[model samples]
Target: MIEDDAAVRRGVVDALEYAGYRTLEAGDGDEGLRMALGASYRLLLLDLVMPGRDGFSILAELKKKRAGQPVIILSARGEEHDRVRGLELGADDYVMKPFSVRELLARVEAVLRRTCERAAPEDKRMIPGGEVDFSEGRIAFEDGVEEALSEREGELLRYLLEAKGRVVSRDEILRHVWGLDPAKTETRTLDMHIMHLRSKLRDKAQDFLVTVRGKGWRVVS
Candidate 1:
C-alpha cells in the first residue's frame, strides 16, 4: 500500500495483511513507484492524492514501463473525473474514501481471482508460435525474451485473444477486466490497452489481432 496519509495508509495496510496478503508500504508515490518496478506483486493499492509524484503520475510512468500491472486507486475525492482519470491511466479498480474493510478486501480478492482465472498455462494455449505464458506471470514473446506482465495487462491480452475473432464490446472488457463499469466515454481505455498489446506483439502482429473499429475488436488468426 502506498499512501501519504499515515492513518489511511496504516489502516489499509493492516487490513490487507489481516486478510492474508503480504504487503509493502510506501509513504509517497515515488517510493511506491520504485517498489512496484523492482518487484512483482499481485496488486497495488494506491492513493491518487499523494505528495511528490501523485498517484496518477506514478500510474502513468509505471504503465509506460510495465503496462500489465494491476492498480486500485483509493481517493477521498470520489469525483467522476478522479475515477475516470484513474481508470484511463490503467487502474484495475478504484475505491472511494470512507470505505469498509469488507469492500476493500472484496475488491482485492476479486481482482486477484480474476487475474488468476485468465492466466492460462503456456502448454495449454493453442497459439501458433506460443502463448503469452500467462500462468508464469510474464509476457513470453516467441522471440525468447520473457517480459514480466503486470497482472492486468496479461489478463487483458488473454481476454482479447480468447475472444477469437468475435467482436467484444468495450463495456464487456471494462466490466470484466476492471471489475467495475467506468463512464461510457472511458471505453477508449480499452482501445489504449489494445494499442499497447499491438505494440508488444511486435512479431506476432499478423497472427490473431484484427481491429473492427467503431463497433469493437476481434482477434483473427
Candidate 2:
C-alpha cells in the first residue's frame, strides 16, 4: 500500500490485514517506488498524486521494469481521463479515494484472480528451433542465441502457447494478460505488445504468432 495520507494508508493496510492478507505500507512516493520495484509483493495499491516521484512516474517505471506486476491505482481524482490514463499506463484497476473497504477488497480480489490465473507455468517449452524456459525467463535458439524475456513477454508467450493453436481474442488477452476488463479497455495496447513480442521471438515470417483477421492471435505451434 502506498499513499501520502497516513490515515488513509493505515486504514487500508489494517483492512487488508483484517481480510487475511499480508500487507506492506509506504507512506510516500519515493519509498513506495523503491519497495514496489524491489519487493516480492503480488499486487500494489498506489495513490496517484503524491510528493516526490508521483504514482504515474512510479507506474511507468514499474511497467518498463516489471510489466507483469499487478497494480491498482487509488486516487481522489475520479475523472474519466484519470481512470483511463491509469488503465493505459498498465494499471489492472483503478479505485477512487473515499472508497469503502468492501469495494476496495472486491477490486483487489478480482485483479488478483486474473493475475494468479495467468502466471507462467513452472516448466519450459521446446519449440521448433528454440526453447523457452519460463522459470528462468530465457529463450534459446538452436544456433546458440539466447535472449531474456521480460515478465510481460514471458506471460504473453505462455498464454499463446497454452492456446494450442486456437485463436485467442484481443479481448481475452486484455483480460487474461493485463487483468483489465476487455470490454472497457482499448485493444491497441494488445497489438503493440504483440509486435514487440514478435520482434523478440524473431518471427521473421510471422510463422509463430499468427494474427487472425477480425478475430485474434494464435500460436502456430
Best lDDT among the predictions, by candidate number = 2
List, residue by residue over 1-221, the lDDT tens digit for candidate 1: 88999998899889988888888899987788787655546788888877778898989976655556788888898989889988999999999988999999999889888766775434334444555667776555566765565678788877777766667656556656776543433545666667777666653454566666665566766
Local lDDT at 69 for model 1: 73
Predicted candidate 2 versus true structure: per-residue lDDT over 77-133, tens digit per residue: 999998998899999999987899999999999999998886646568987689999
**TM-scores, all models, native as reference:** 0.57, 0.59
Clashing pairs in 1: 68-150, 68-153, 69-150
What local distance difference test score does each model get? 0.74, 0.85
Pairs of residues at least 3 apart in sequence or in different chains that clash in candidate 2: none
Off by over 4 Å in 2: 119-126, 129-221
